[model samples]
Target chain A: MLNIKNLHVKLEDEDKQILKGVDLTVPAGEVHAIMGPNGSGKSTLSYVLSGRDGYEVTEGEASLYDHDLLDMEPEERAAAGLFLAFQYPVEIPGVGNLTFLRTAVNAQRKARGEDELSSGEFLKVVREKAKTLQIDADMLKRPVNVGFSGGEKKRNEILQMAMLEPKMCILDETDSGLDVDAMRLVAEGVNALRSPERSFLVITHYQRLLDHIKPDVVHIMSNGRIIKTGGPELALEVEKNGYGDLLAEVG
Target chain B: MADTAVLASKAPVAEKPRSVLDARLEALDLPRGGFTAAARADAADRLNAMGLPGKRDEYWRYTDPAAFNAPTAEPLAFTSRASTLFDEIEQLKLVFVDGRFDADASDALDGEGLEISTLAAADAAGDHWAADLYGKLETAGQNPVKRPFAVLNTLAATDGVLIRVTGKVSRPVHILYRREAQDADVTIHHVIRLEEGSELTLLETGGIAARSNVAIEVEVNKEARFHHIASKRADDAKVGIGHVFARVGEGALFKSFTLSVNGSMMRNEGVIEIVGDDAVAHIAAAVLGDGTEGRFHHDDTVFITHAAERCESRQVFKKVLKNGADGIFQGKILVKPGAQKTDGYQISQGLLLDEGSQFLAKPELEIYADDVKCSHGSTTGALDETAMFYLRSRGVPKEQAVVLLVLSFLADALEEIEDDRLRDDILTRLDEWLTSRASA
Candidate 1:
């Protein structure tokens, strides 16, 4: 469902390269986790795939569902079924969370040549989806992430993911700043969306998130490239021994 | 009427001026006759002393007062026919034609707890309640900067209205201006008084004249409430200057908001004084000056005084400028000595769409009471880039996203409106304006 070959990305304002010669692939219907140490280009990978500004793809190519992801704008990418749950969800003052969600949902639907949802229909769906994540009515009424707690913001991201139902999902450090109970709730929400036609690229530095929503395959990312590949047990090994043994062995 | 028309047809062309300030004022014609001798002399003297604010004046530095201070202007035949707002509900409609009350087109003035009459009618009635309020508030509000045009309006206003409310008014009052001739200079003055525990809402719409000067004097007595919402728009050739002088009594509430969409030149001034303890006042404006042929200039000058203990006041102004348009905001909050526990807030912000457009803001706060809470802030910037990206990433197109951000920036000022229906009407017009702007 997602493919990247020798993806080289650099800071748009400087010569520093964040993602250097990275190659990875995730087939349809599989959950793939990329475990990496600090500053190992984890978040950078997510940003590049999501078409964020201030990043230059110096070399290589990335595609989703065989579409030229690198050629599309960020909104076009979202319309093409790519979702990125940010590590730090944006706080947009004055734009109600419900208003933001309805606008996004309708905009994507229009771009996809689908009928827009009426207010009544949209409100019903949002409320139902929000119920599973414990996002109360008042939370949906407030501005987007304006006064949200850390866990609430992560869960709000998950709620958006459920609403959009993208084909390829990227969760960048979703487990950070989340307590054990909050992490489990987020994992449950993610696990409920698993389907035969969907895929997930879970980028995390810890294995606790994988405990609730197990991944089909695990890859060890170092210095902007995937250097090791293994099964779910690989995540446990990294959790127990950390990245020191793997980095030393690779050297 | 025939004689007036003959005089209008035979009007002499205003000669080239050796001095802009000297050649004006005495030439103006008051259609409804003049005010009391002393009152007119006082107003005219105050105006002559200040002259017309020049570009060199500190308060008028950002905006040139040349258009407002022009020596002579020919009448213009306005052709645009725009619909008036707040027509969806029941209202008492008062129409004015070039600053003269059109009694034939106005509604009957009969309502419970309210006494409304035209300025001409009130003047003809001989001594009345309006005599006490006619220019009292205007005279009391001229402390820091004297508004020469407002004083001129007080002296020369042809016809307006005097409204007094003794109890809750069920319906809003609408003042409609229908312009037929261009280059016409109109001076209008209105006086409103609210007795103890009374309430009122006043709505104003339309372009009054090509060159217009309006003065609104309001008094909110103990436990009274008042709301003023005005939306003014005009083409590139029009110039309008308006002022509001309001005094709030003990435990009274007064709120006023204005939406200025398009004009060649518009300067709106608001001066509010809270004299009674526990009174509250809020004055806000959302202005936009966007035009195609030439720059649209808008200025909002507000002064709010807190003189009583535990009184609260707020002043908010937000402006959006584009296509070389210019916007100016000058506001101050004063907390008088012994006015302890006074709370005041002032914020002025501007969003410039292009480098050619400019925004000048002067926000000030003077506090003499040690236990007061006061804060003032001013910012001039482009749209928030990060917020723009976030909205665009969510699939809202660039234009729609910008509109969202702009509307969000103005939400606070819009919230000052007390009536939901009136607020929604203004909001719909604003939305249409933004949509057309996006296409243009």
Candidate 2:
């Protein structure tokens, strides 16, 4: 569902290279996990894929199916069935949560040339989805992410992911601020969306989150490139021995 | 009526060269044979005392008063854009073209608990109830800050409407000002008096003229309520100055909101005095300025005083500027001695769409009461980048995302409008302006 070949990225404002000739790919309906040390360019890959500003791609290409992902705008990337669950969800005041979701949903639908959902239809679908995520009416009525707890923000992000039904999903440290129960809840929400046509690239720093949403393949990233790829047991090995032995073995 | 020379002799020494003020005054003639004759003469004396505002003047520092100081308005092409803001609401309509009341186009000035008359007709009657209120509130509002243009408006105003409400008015009084003259230099003064236990809503829309000075004096008695909503949408080359002076009595409510769009130079000043206990006053404005519309510069200046115990006052102003447009806000809230438990709040914010645009704000709070709650805040910023990316990543187009963020930035000022329908109407128009600009 997603492919990257020798991607290189650097900061736009500074002379700092974030991602150096990294290469990885995730097939359809598969879950792949990439674990790395801090400042190892895990988050940079997600940002560059989502078409955020202040990032310059110096080399390589990435694509979803036949479409060149780097050439599309963020909204176009989204309309092409790509979703990124942010690590720190932005708090936008004065914009109602329901209004934002409705706008986003209709926007993508319009971009894809699909019939827009009516208000009543949208309410019904959102009500059903929010119930599973344990988001109440107040959460939907308030301003987007403003005053929400960390767990609530993560759940809101996953709820958005569920509503969009993207073909390729990237979770960038979604487990960073969540507690045990919140993590379980978020993992269950993500797991519920796993289908034969959907794929996930889960980026986490711990095996604890992987325990909830098991990955088919685990990759160890050091510096800017992935150095090792193995089964789920690799996550346990990293949890026990840490990246010290893995980085030394690669070196 | 007093002659210009006699009034000038009684005036204070001109702060600047007297040539400018003298030439401006020499070009205008005060209305004769009116009940407002004595009041107009007093105002003329006051105007001569203050003279025309200079750039160095304290209140005029942010906004240049050169346009108002000119002897005649620079000729402008009349715009044909008509406002359909309050057409859906049932109301009494009054139409004025080039500052002259149109008797044929206006509805009959007859309504239950309402007495409305043109200033010219009322002045011809020799005497009226508004005689006591004529220019009284404007004179009271001159303290702490001298508004020479408002004084001049009261002195040389050629026509306006006089309204007095004795009981609860069932419908709003809608005043529509239309411009048909290119070189129309217009002055209008309105007097409104609401008796005890009465309520009224006044709606004003459209542009007055190429250059206009408009003032409204409101006297709300005990337990009365007054709501004023005005929208100014003039051509890009227009220059206008508007002032509202209100005195709210015990247990009364006074609220005023304005929406201004697409003006070259516009200044709006509001002075509200709450003299009775438990009175409430609110003044708010939303400005949409685009410098592409000919050197856009808009200013909002508000001063509210709490003189009685437990009085409340609020000031909310928001501006959205783009393409080098300039927006200025100067607001002050003062709580007098013995006005215990007074609650005053003021917030002014500006959103600059580009780096070239600028927002200047001055928020002040003066409190003499020991037990009072007062807060003031002012902010100038661009749209939030993180929020923008979040919306765009969620699939909203860039232009649509900008409109959403701009509307969200203005929601606070729009909330000050109590009527849901009126607020919705203003929101609709604002959205249209933003959408059209985005497409362009």
Candidate 3:
């Protein structure tokens, strides 16, 4: 459902390339895990796919279900069923989480020419979803990510992805700051949202998160390029042997 | 009719008080002969001795009172009939033009547990409360910088709406102060009193014409609750100045919201004092100014926990400046000694949409007690670029994105208003003002 062909990107001011000819593809009904070391362009891939500014796409194309995702704005991409669970979500003060969520949902619905949800119906759905995610109603009433704990903010981002229910989900370092319990809860939430027509790309540096959400494919990335691909067993092998041996082999 | 004509024809008598000090005392038509006359004369002499505040005054530094020369509008004639701005409000309306009350257009409340009459009529009925509380909250000696308008309002204001709610009243009170023309100076003093356990919602809106030098005073007793929402939508040719003084008693709750849309030069000075323990006061304001010469200034001061413990106070202000207009917001929260456990918060934020637009926000907190939680924050900047880009990338136009961000910036202040109707009305007015200003 998601495809990236020889994607190359660079900083706008400097000609220094960040994503050098990276290629990836994830079909429906499967989760693909991209494990990389620090500064391997995993987060940069997420930002480019999510249409964040300050990065120029120098080469290749990214498409979501036959649509040109690279040309769409961040919000348009969101409406087009592309969701990116950011490593660091923006904190919007004075804007309540519930209000922000509703606005985003309604905006997407309006783009799709669907009827808008009433306040009562929206509140009911949000309450149920929040309960399922173990998020308090008071948290939903507060300013978005303002004064929220690290785990709480990550969970809030996951909650948004669930609400948006995108066709392609990109989890960039979703397990960075989460504890064992929080990681388990987050994995469970992601697992529950999996479907035959939906796909996910879980990008992380550690293999601990891979134990909860089993991936069908594992890819190793270094120096802004994907160097190797293997089955789920490859994740276990890397966990035991580490990336140092693999870096020498790639060289 | 004869009274109004006589006052209108006596223009030379009004023009004699040119200086700020003389202008204030002469604005009020004090009694010619009586004990009250001598007392008013003494008060006027005291006001004259104080003189107009200069730039050296700390509080008046940002706003120079010397620049605003005293207005010289002829006193309104005695007309029992006058028009109103909004007809949907059914309550009795008191009309004051150039600081003179129109007895014909006003109504008196004479029912049980309720007293609604003119200040002149109430004083004639030997109501000592009227005289004692008239200028008590706005003592010239105490607040020397911003009391010139208050002093003028006290001494010159002939007739005003006197509302005394003894018991719980269900209906809302609407006081409409309509400025007829911008030819001369005018000052109005409106006093409201709510007895113990009384509840009221007062709506005050300025008229279409420009009004110079207007002041209103409100006092709430113990256990009383009041919600005052004042809106100003004046024309560009008019210059307006207003001051609101509120003294909240013990256990009483008072909330004041002021919204200003368009004016040539406008200033609103707000002072809310919490005297009784456990009293609460919430002051919120939104001011919008545009055009080359349009300027708006707001000075809000709130004193909580004066003698009462555990008092709570909040003040929030938002301003939008465009074109060459200027907006100023100065808010201070004071927690007096012995006022323990006081909770106070003050925030002032402004959005400057153009290069020539200017905003000055000063938020301060003075606490004498160590066991209190008081904080003040001020921010003045353009719209958030990331939020704007995010919205624009979603197919939203740039203009629409700006409108959304501006509205979001003002949402916090607007949410403090409890009445939905008033809130919606003010939002609509703001939207219109923004659109027109942008187009211009």
Instruction: Point to the candidate with the largest lDDT.
Output: 2
* Segments in model 1 whose C-alpha atoms lie over 4 Å from true places: B1-19, B31-37, B73-81, B234-237, B291-293
DockQ of candidates 1 onward, in order? Answer: 0.63, 0.72, 0.21
In the range B1-440, model 1's lDDT, one tens digit per residue, is: 35334434533421222145566765776434333345666776666555566676677877888877886654645656755678796888888887788888878886887899887776765667787788778888877566777777777877788899999997888888878777678888899999999999998888788888899999999999999998885443578889999999999999999988777788999999999999999999988777564558889999999999999999889998888888889899988999999999999999997788889888888888999999989999998877777777667767878887888788888988978899888877787678667755
Winner of 2 and 3 under lDDT: 2
What's the true lDDT of residue B220 in model 1? Answer: 98
**By TM-score, is 2 or 3 better?**
2
lDDT of 3 by residue, A45-102 (tens): 9889988788999999999897898998777787788888877766676667886787
The residue-by-residue lDDT of candidate 3 on B10-31, one tens digit each, is 5455343335555544544454
lDDT of 2 by residue, A1-251 (tens): 89999999999999899989888889999999999899899999999999999899999999998879999999999999999999999987767899889999999999999999999999999999999999999999988899999999999999999888899999999999999999999999999999989999999999999999999999888788988999999999999999999999999
lDDT of each: 0.85, 0.90, 0.72
